[model samples]
Target: MSILIDGLLAILAIYLALQSLLAPRLSQSVFLFFAFGLALALAWVRLGAVDVAITEAAIAAGFLGVLFLDALRDFSSTISEKHNNTEAIQSSASRKKIKTFLLPRLAFGVGLGLFLLISLEAIWQIPQGGGLTAAAESMLPESGVEHPVTAVLLNFRAYDTWLEIGVILLGLLAIFVTGGIKIYTKPDVVAKDPLLRQVILFFTPVLFLFGAFLLYIGKSGPGGAFQAAVLWGAIGILLHLGGKPVFAMIPRWVGQLVLIMGLGFFLLMGFVFMSGGATLFEYPKAYAGTLILIVETLAAISIAAALTAIYANLNQMKEEPKENESAN
Candidate 1:
């Protein structure tokens, strides 16, 4: 059974890779890749790797799937191209001229060959020296978290996580900045969908609250920064799709300051620790939960705004005075 399951998963992964490479429409590819992620999570769980499975399911299956779909939506053609689910041709007579594509093919082949050669050596031999499980076992008691990976994420490799948060913030800033120049349009109106609209309106707030709850619970459980951020972002997306007000065109200073507040405050906290003769970001256990909760909440708010702004790129809008001043 185990062998069969693994083989099926391998086949699914191969199929997903091909679908992504060959799908004429990008949307199909993204959703198929998401299915691939689900398969990967299953495989991880079978291997007794819960952390990797959670990451695969939550980070890749959920958040990455949404992110890719969002990107596909953004790249939507001027006219919606409707595609039929027709059987794909297995062999192509020819595709775009080879001279233009040959170089990329050659480069990809070389890269894949080298990667395989390097990877095989590592996979075939068992490491005789330090192993991750041993290191994690040694560090768990000192980490103050039951889950080893969480301990590593928050404590052992905190600086790495902090920098990653910075990268996320930068990516959000770039999206918002570039999105400002984008033409914003209201989503297509659905006719006589009062029942569905009412249903959505009724439960949307509840969902938002649930997402917040997940984020808060993350401190003690399998959830955390990424999961919470995605949930919060999902609420904003739902609000936007439901045609609710989903933007805040604040002053540039306000936006910039809000964007940096999490990192700024984190750095200040680190400075305080360092001033007390502790190393950089060597957060005292005393302030751990409080500091983490604060950072998480701020991050959630900033992330929500950035995600909403991706859809609603309202540039700086001048307030319109009452009625006929311009006409006069």
Candidate 2:
């Protein structure tokens, strides 16, 4: 029964992935991509990596899904404008160009096929039932967390986790640089549906409570900082869609502090520990659990802020006017 379920999930995942890539319409592809993420999340759960599954479902299906849908809306509008200008030229040339790169397309397809075969071969060659499970289990008692995944992420591999947080901050920085630091401006038109308002009210508190619950639960279960951050970040997104724009209401300095608190505190702790003749991020066994909890809490807040900022910036972006429109 378990094997059959796994097989079904595997097939669904593969089908969704292929359809998402090959779908002719942007909206169809985006929806298919969401399906693929959910399928992949289920696969992760079946593999017993619930932490990974949660993160995958939240970030991929939830966050990235919203981003992709927004992008699709923006892209569709831009394409519509361009199509009006180039429809005649494109209509005449589209069919002629269809077969122009036949050989190159065939070669690219063949290359992809070979790559897939090579990847499968490599997977099959990997040794099974040989990993760091035994070692991790042995060290679990001293790692300051009962959950092995939490232990590995917060203690055993603290450096990598720290860098992961840094990467998220850097991604937000990149977005700011490219998009010119869009502060959340209130939309000219806000949705005033009572049902939508009710839904937002219901979910807002639920997400906040769940995010905090997940952060605390990470010490013993599948929940953690990243999962909690996604939930918290989602609250901001929900509010934005509901016309609240919570991030925009906050003072700029406060926003900056919240955004940096996680990474900054993490580095400060690392340096403090290093002063005690220990390496960076190597917490003393006596205070490890407390330190990990603090770091996780702060990291969750910072991550949530960064994610909300990214979404707000993307959501508020205005389409640049075309030359003809500008002249008019």
Candidate 3:
């Protein structure tokens, strides 16, 4: 029964991937991509990788879908109908030519068959059961977190997590350098609908509360700082969509401080520990768990702020044409 279930999920995932790849409309393709992510997440869950599934569902599917949908809205009006029709006709002709070419079809089929055979062989070779389970379990207590993945992320592989946080901050920096931080300050001229506003107002607090809960439970469960941070970022995006500039309400310097707090605190913690003769990022066994929690909390905050800043930059970019038009 489990094998059947896995087989079904695999088939569904493949279907979603094909749909995402073949969809012509940008909006359709984005939605299909979201569905593809969700399908893959389910596959991950069936394979018992709940943490990976959560990240895939939340960040890959939900967060990216929202981002793409927003960008699609911003550029949807720019598409020319005549150009679209011309492209459609050309694409149709090309499809016919491809169908008429038997040799090309045969070559494509042979290539696909070879690829599938190789993939199946790779899957079959994967060893059944856990690798490094004993090693991880033996060192779990020293690593700070009860969950193996959490321990690996926050303790054993701390540098990787730190660099990941740095990457998020760097993305925000790039956005800020390209577009000013005041992007969120400009008012959203198109007022959001009352129903949307009401929904956002009601859910914003709940979102933050849930995100905090996720962060707190991450040491022992599938939830983590990254998932929590994405949730908070999603809330910020929702608020923006509802015509609220939450970032603008906070002082620019304060926002910047929050954005850097995670990386700064992480570096400080590492250096302080190193000064005590411990290796960099080697949490003292006595305070390992506590330090992990503190770092994760701050990292979540910085990540949330950075992601919100990215959306704000996108919002500003979308409004540039309107500003230029008004100037004209």
Best by TM-score: 2
- lDDT by residue for model 3 (1-328), tens: 6799899888988998887766666677777888888888989998899988888877876577767877886666434555775765677666665566556769999999999999999999987878888988899989878899999999988999999999988887887777655556544443446776777788889889999999998999998999999989988877776677778878878988998999999999999999999998998998999999999999999999888878877777766667779999
Least accurate 10 contiguous residues by lDDT in model 2: 76-85
> In terms of TM-score, which candidate is stronger, 2 or 3?
2
Q: Number of clashes in every candidate structure? A: 0, 0, 0
Q: Which is the better candidate, 1 or 3, if ranked by TM-score?
A: 3
Question: Could you tell me which residue pairs clash in candidate 3?
Answer: none
Clashing pairs in 2: none
For residues 3-117, write the lDDT of model 2, one tens digit per residue: 9999999999999999887776678878889989999999999999999999998888779999998887677532343354366446556666545535567989999999999
- TM per candidate comes to 0.72, 0.90, 0.85
lDDT of 1 at 319: 17
- Per-residue lDDT over 1-328 for candidate 1, one digit per residue giving the tens place of the 0 to 100 score: 6799889888887788777667666677777778778877888887877656765776675556656665664466422333322212123235554444466779999999999988988888857876688888886666555556666776677787678668877776676565444334344342137776787677677757866776666666666665566666666665655655344334667766766776677678778989999888776777666666676677666665565555444221111222236766
Question: Which residue runs does candidate 1 get wrong by more than 4 Å?
Answer: 49-52, 59-63, 70-118, 126-128, 177-192, 249-258, 311-328
How does model 1 fare in lDDT? 0.64
